[model samples]
Target: MSSLYLLHKPYRMLSQFTDSEGRATLADVIDVPGVYAAGRLDYDSEGLLLLSDDGALIHRIAHPRHKQPKTYWVQLEGQMDESALKALRSGINLKDGPTRPAKARLMTPPALAPREPAIDPKRHPSTCWLELTISEGRNRQVRRMTAHVGFPTLRLIRASIGAWQLGDLQPGEWRRETLHAPRPAKSAKRSGKPTATRPRRHS
Candidate 1:
């Protein structure tokens, strides 16, 4: 059995265990040894984060090729129109490349504790919430996507990743789950002769 940790990572905490700059890190919240973050949340972002001791599980969760859907509750600085939602659903051409189509829609504000340093109302007089889901993992992708469509993200909180939900865990709180490691697919055997099979491409 493998150990998986679901942590409600707090805002302004580094994803890693150590930081030379004396910033808050995972070590401050989680005391688990041997397990590492499967995927990273930006230091300024908050919400669910998965950690595991199994390398295969970590790869499956973190790799973009796996296409695990990550859902976020995004607070935008301004109201986002339908046209912008449609654009996000279509695709956004980013500096790295064109992103895959995503699911975006207006949503009611979530009932959660206020951030330590909350957004200033004066800086953003009008704000709206959006429920956005994307399969691909890119560095700062969610923020960039919204900014590209003219609605800058003021706050980002991941609600779920694949089937894992944030649930009732409060900031800095964590829970552990045990899971069987994923088994690799076996190669097909031919009756007459050994046939060569091309490796599957991740893309």
Candidate 2:
């Protein structure tokens, strides 16, 4: 049977199941075997991450060719502007190549918990938030794009990937579901507490 796990990863946690540095890992919480993460979230990022035992589904979720859009609530270091939004909505030229057009909108912050060690206010920089959805999965693409447009990102929380969402899961919480199994309408969410919060993009 194939398995899927939706985990709300907290910040500064590794996405791998194990680490030689003795840092907190997925094995610290996920007791199950034979399942691997479909994608990886960055160590510095926080939000929904998916793991699965189904290889094909993992490929579909992680492959850029599939064009599964990723959504994030981003806190910018300074104010947002029309020019920046236009550039992002169109495409941002990065070192590698130009990104595809995205669904970009400036938004008020979402209701989320504070980071364990809060962002420093000493810099006295104004901050704005944006909800960005992109189909292309690149390394630090969202942050790089925002910074490319002259607004450095202060915080980034991924809200959902394709059809999956963070929903009501809190930090370190996880829910498991098996697609092949039959179920009633309500029996979907499973619970776990894992250290990793960053789900990876297609790599």
Candidate 3:
């Protein structure tokens, strides 16, 4: 059986174990040997990051083809309008290409622990929070989406991925669980081909 770990990756920390630049890395927080991060979380973004020793599980979670949904709590630099939210929900044409439609909505500021070297209120006086959920994992996609809609993201926090949530895990804290094999896909009636399905999502 494989081992799975849910970690609250802190801001300004690299996802990998080593950093030649001497910046903080996962080794500072996670001491487990042989386990590797399934997907990357930006050094500046803080939130839930999944790590595991199971190569197959890592592939399923990290591969864009799997389309595992990831939700973020975004702090935008300006007031959010319905048009912006609608555009986000509809999809935005980015430099990489048009993104998939995402679940976007205005949310009240969440009560989150202040990050070290928090966003200076002087630089960004007015801001609003947004809850954005997307199935694709692109490099800085959340930040780009908000920027394209005229609202720059001042801060971003990934709230959940698929069925796993950050919950009450504090910075640098991690929880471990045993992995289980996924259910086999059911065969289609006409084609006799297996239909793809993922684990149930978090409510």
Candidate 4:
């Protein structure tokens, strides 16, 4: 048997279980021993982060060779246009390297909780919303990409990874489940049985 946990990692929480500094880490929320985050989400970023006690599962989720698609709901600092979207979809060059092509589209913001430090409406900066799916994970890749296209990301919330979704889990919440293999990856969330939700966890 395997232990898999899907956590809605809150903003400002470190992806690792421990930190030299007293800042919040996964230890603050997760009590499941031996299960580690399969991939990382930046402290400034929020949303679904998968953890598992199984090493093979971790590799499958985190390794670039696996090419698991991660979907994000992004709010940007300027109006979005077709040209910018085309650059995102065609793979723009970044400091790290030229990125692989990705899926990007204009979107209405989804119902999400306000960040601890909400974007001030007083500034009244024009903004746009985009939903992007990319198979490659790089350090702050989405944020950098948006900025390269001239619409700096104001907020980044990863909504899904492959078939697993954040669903209705609020910040610092998690669910445990067993995933069976061999299903169609693209359609799993839409067609699979309802995922069992667990109770909220507190630090």
For each of the candidates, the C-alpha root-mean-square deviation to the true structure, in angstroms, is 9.7, 7.1, 6.4, 4.1
Model 4 earns a TM-score of: 0.90
State the lDDT at 65 in candidate 3. 91
Q: Which ten contiguous residues of candidate 4 have the minimum total lDDT?
A: 188-197
Please give the range of 10 consecutive residues that has the lowest summed lDDT in model 1. Answer: 194-203
lDDT, candidate 3, 1-203, per-residue tens: 56778888889999999988999998888778999998999999999999988889899899989888999999999899999999999999999999999999999898787989999999999999999999998899999999999999998999999988888777888888675454455632333222222222221
Q: What residue pairs clash in candidate 2, if any at all?
A: 9-197, 40-199, 40-200, 41-198, 41-199, 41-200, 175-190
Better of 1 and 2 by TM-score: 1
Query: What C-alpha lDDT do the candidate models reach, one value each?
Result: 0.87, 0.82, 0.87, 0.88
Model number with the top lDDT: 4
| Clash-forming residue pairs, model 3 | none
Error of 3 at 32 (Å): 0.9
Q: What tens-digit string does per-residue lDDT give for candidate 2 at 3-77?
A: 678887788877888888887676665666887877888888988888887888799789879899999999888
Tens digits of lDDT, candidate 4, 20-52: 988899988888888889999999999999999
Off by over 4 Å in 1: 181-203
lDDT of 3: 0.87
When sorted by lDDT, best at the front, the candidate numbers are 4, 1, 3, 2
The C-alpha stretches of model 2 lying farther than 4 A from their native spots are: 181-203
Error at 187, model 1, angstroms: 18
